[model samples]
Target: MIKLPTISTYYGGKGSSGTYQKIINHVRPHDTLIIPFLGNCALTRRIQWPAQVIANDLDPYIIDQWRNAELGPRLDLYNLPALDFLATVLKRPNLGRVVIYCDPPYPLGSRKSQQLRYHFEMTDRDHEELLTAIRFLRVDCLVSTYPNERYAQQLSHWNRTEFQSQTRHGAATEWLFYNYPIPEVLHDTRFAGNNYREREYIKRKAARWVAKWALLPPHEQQHIMEQLIIVTPNVIVNQINN
Candidate 1:
């Protein structure tokens, strides 16, 4: 049997699909969305971004994968440093109502260093550059990071969000900072259940029930299988009629 690489097999960062939709709610296809620091390009593959979506990163390999990801004509992936490319894109005129999402390398000083790993590791200066750049930007932006005393102290004026996420490492809490108020649509997570996580949950739930049934004693298992033969056909017929 051949083992397939799951979503986690992609190194470094992968954004939650639900989070991606919240980011999507703010815009339509006519707007320009810039993802300055594309880690796993999760933001790219997960949603059909309405407007033009431009994404860039420091790594060429990631750029290759991003371009080849079959997202469609609206997405333009590039290999470039995050700050410089972002600055260039922001400067472009007539682009109008730009939405820049900065999901960058976690700084060494941040508490997130324990759970997060990145090949393009960010230093203290890099963190400062990123935060300062976003603060002054005229464009609307969403920045993802984790909680830290220094960040709270430095960015006290900006709005912060504690997003719920889980990992095998444990139930993890990540953060998001925005220069402007996040839209009410993003805050409402009720519809977010339509993603892969819910489907995976249902699949695992069914598997557990089947596994428990297998563990029954031989006679019981035989009796149950016999019963299933009679019950399964009727159930299938009812489902087909429905």
Candidate 2:
């Protein structure tokens, strides 16, 4: 897994994690990464060209957006059920070094709560089916999820990392499991969101945002920087200095 450049830039709707940048960075420009379940597609938009991304989801709305996006050769849009589409990609001849980076629907913890939360829903069986396929396929993959017993047992050999990212209530824990060993640069992410490292976090985050500003598309770049209490690079500097 080759590490691409790091950036503070992030996107996607609710429940989205910024750690995908680590997964995306590892994808080599020459290889193909299949996005089986493209949600709001923070990863799809962030990917710079020369590296090809096949972005697909069951949602027609998502497909339409992708089709209209003038991303040039960097992205290909499709609307297909994830499992069938994944099967199709794998069967293709001459497909070299393919990586599947996906975020699927979370398991139905509460039918009542989940029904209101997400349009699409998943079950334990669905999770099992996907895991079964992945286990036999012999491919490199990264999947994100909450901790589950089935996953721990099935993917025991795979590398795992615990991540902390912001969510509505406060902080949330998410797990990233990869089929191959991830390098330290990709795995050892320390986000100082606490009061203890407040000054240091801002300084580091400022630098990260700076690195990504030029590379990211203007709209995405804007969204990422907008919610920040500290806005521009110059302002970030001012806050640190003050």
Candidate 3:
């Protein structure tokens, strides 16, 4: 199979189906498919393999959207948490070679009150739980996550490989997780590269600073920085003294 690009035009992109189809071609005909987090079901709908798929998510609205869709795999969008979904998958007797594609929320420290955010941050403990869930499956599995040191360490236990691609906005690094061994030849396939110009633009935009006081020791730094924006004299002069 060919190497698929990782980047998407949007978070839930339309080209995901093509990527899913490539993945399906690698697996056997009667394997069971389990997708834990169904954002838009674009990928699930595109997979044409004749396998039993159990697509689910904790988001009720997303599940509702999947339920109302005219096409896609037969999904059971559960309202339960991720652990609950894993338990349900474990209890299934027809646990053949299972393929799981998960895109859990990348919870950095910046996301404070997002509705879809998870409580426990992405740490080694959470990574262990994720890996344990992946191991629980009786069949082959594939997982995806944003590139981070913690996630990289977690994925090291699996047949890990990296894919880089560019979206319209910028570049992205995606790691693919597989339980069983894959050949070396499949690993060398060339995928698309990220647009460096766009990436640089975003980097520059995100490089603004609050103040050195904000960067002081955590205990010494004031808590108001979260609610207030500290401006330099140049900024103040530009606005008032001009």
Candidate 4:
């Protein structure tokens, strides 16, 4: 978990630092993650990254900030329109197990204020196009948005989960829509529970297991790990299918 320097903030950044755990609870493994709507990259920065990560934003200032961070050679940063970036990426070959996580500008129709605050604000039409593009993508996709009628109608078939979050204006319900079912194997197990209490309970339970395992003899530990390796895949497959 090498942490990169934090990027500067933007107006209406949709910084998910507060709610990222909730959103990440629904994530699963992928070879690469594409963030076409990278703002401050709050959620992206916090996640357990995959083999590769590509983030894009139309705003040059935001991309420049990321570039200045020297985010290392592994991260591919782009300053391109979201849809165009997606289209270009899709054309590339051998993209195995890609996941696109979009935190696009909140639709004006769903917001309290009619005034646009972002460097690039999205209209209802813009949201429609984005949602449509996501719908047709062959690989997995996850989107964060408010509970808007147009969004609901467009992504009606997609699976959705929500979390209560605090915004500058006050409390709000943030929805995460995914094309896949909730995975049996998570991308990161650090945020594994439904709520704060449950998460703490899981943390304690894992700690207890770790302590108990540490007390076991070397032979016993090896035997247990071997058995688990032999059994886990089938169990996971069964759980996912059901």
Candidate 5:
């Protein structure tokens, strides 16, 4: 029988105690850390490392929150463009092993509408660019994402591993993609939500808007109004219709 570390024991309230411990166990003290889209740094603050740490995200609000932390001085927090951030990191003198922990946005099409704001709907080309940029780092990186077929296919090129675990509220199966092989252990799992009306409402509205937009002609687009207004004379014309 194969046994893995039980995470339930260190599931601290609100913050991360067990997950950080697991991360620390995986990474040595000297490894440089990079956490992308760190929301409040709930899991990151617990990482006990003697090396340098960099927390990056496209959201200025998130970066501001992280920067305001009492322990913010220890970690390097950057509020820059994602590609620019990668470029800056690449140019650093000491390009050692970097452990990147990314929790990118999972667009579920909610009323809040964070998709456009965060540009969460990443394509294969975007992931390929990211993979190429960070592949040279001399360390293992862990990325957490919701289970999706497109994402799985995109990451299939890497050595992939899956870990099935239940969150505090629900059961989730997470995949871990690594450059190297890791141990796989079997864990006995248990079973499992109803807001059907709300979901249907969103779906219907989205479909309606999509259909409306699809029917719109090229010249009838919103941008066309600006050009039309510019070309039209401001003077009033005599109305003559036959």
Candidate 6:
């Protein structure tokens, strides 16, 4: 497994926990992940490495912290308002296979009826605007938020799945709204399987295959790999066409 640098602690930061893997399962290694409302960038750090990650936040302090963290070349940090940053990204040419993951602050209504303050809070209108902005984008998008009638109405056409997330206060239900159909095969096989046990089983099976391959002579190994490279594309195309 690829090791990624850990993001520093920030107020209102979504730490490296909860249902982030569920969201990452939908991403491919080739996808350019855009985080418009980057807080701690919990999701960006945990996703498959060597993937392009563009993250922006309104707070310059957080952006500077990330700059000092040495997060490597794969991640580009931007200090701009979420929507403005997204607008800049949209103007760029040839941004291949983009996936925008929106984790804006929880709406006021969803904040357990208490006035919880953050450095930047997304008002009801701001949340609506964010959702509206991504609605027309050609790239795939996934939004993480609490369940509410406003989102239900706005994202009625979008696919949704819910999972329990631990909040500072208690457990809360978090929802993911996505625009694309779930691929039968995830781009990153590391995130496959329905549960941890199944995942471990697959991992062991993969290790066994690697062990077997290692025993092959160098020339035979090269031949097998070349054959796989030739056939893999056609198999992927057939899957897509089916």
| TM-score of structure candidate 1 | 0.66
Residues 4-114, candidate 2, lDDT per residue (tens digit)?
222223122322345444445344323567888887655554554335667677877666656665656656777877888898777766556567776787555612234
TM-scores for all candidates: the values are: 0.66, 0.64, 0.57, 0.89, 0.53, 0.81
Question: Model 3: per-residue lDDT, tens digit, 90-197?
Answer: 688866645666656553522233343432235456556876666545566677655666656656767766664343335555565666666322211122113445
TM-score ranking from best candidate downward: 4, 6, 1, 2, 3, 5
lDDT of 1 by residue, 1-242 (tens): 31211245554354554555544444322367788887675555554454577889887767776666566677777777788898677767767657777877755565443654665767778877777777767767777766666567666787786755544444556677766764533321323433568746756777899899878899998887678768787544433332
Preferred candidate (TM-score higher): 3 or 4? 4
Q: CA lDDT of each candidate? A: 0.63, 0.61, 0.52, 0.80, 0.50, 0.74
TM-score of 3: 0.57
lDDT tens string, model 4, 1-242? 56564654464544544587877777777778889988876668777787778889998988887788876766888889899999988777766778899988888877767787887888777887888888866788989888888888888898999887767778788888999988777777788888778898999999999999999999999999778767896655543442
Residues 1-242, candidate 5: write the lDDT tens digits. Answer: 21211223222111432333333333322346777656544446554543667778776766665565545344787876556776786567774656666555542421133334343344556655665665545556665554666556656655554544345545545554555444221010000001335545766777898798788897677666566556653411111100
RMSD of 5: 23.7
Candidate 2 vs candidate 5: which has greater TM-score? Answer: 2
Specify the poorest-scoring 10-residue window by lDDT in model 2: 184-193
Q: How accurate is candidate 2 locally (lDDT)?
A: 0.61
lDDT: worst 10-residue window of model 4: 8-17
Off by over 4 Å in 4: 1-9, 13-18, 226-231, 235-242
lDDT for model 6 comes to 0.74
* Each model's Cα RMSD: 13.0, 12.7, 21.9, 3.2, 23.7, 4.0
Worst 10 residues of 1 by lDDT: 184-193
Which of candidates 4 and 5 reaches a greater TM-score?
A: 4
In terms of TM-score, how similar is model 6 to the real structure? 0.81
Find the candidate with the highest TM-score and give its number.
4
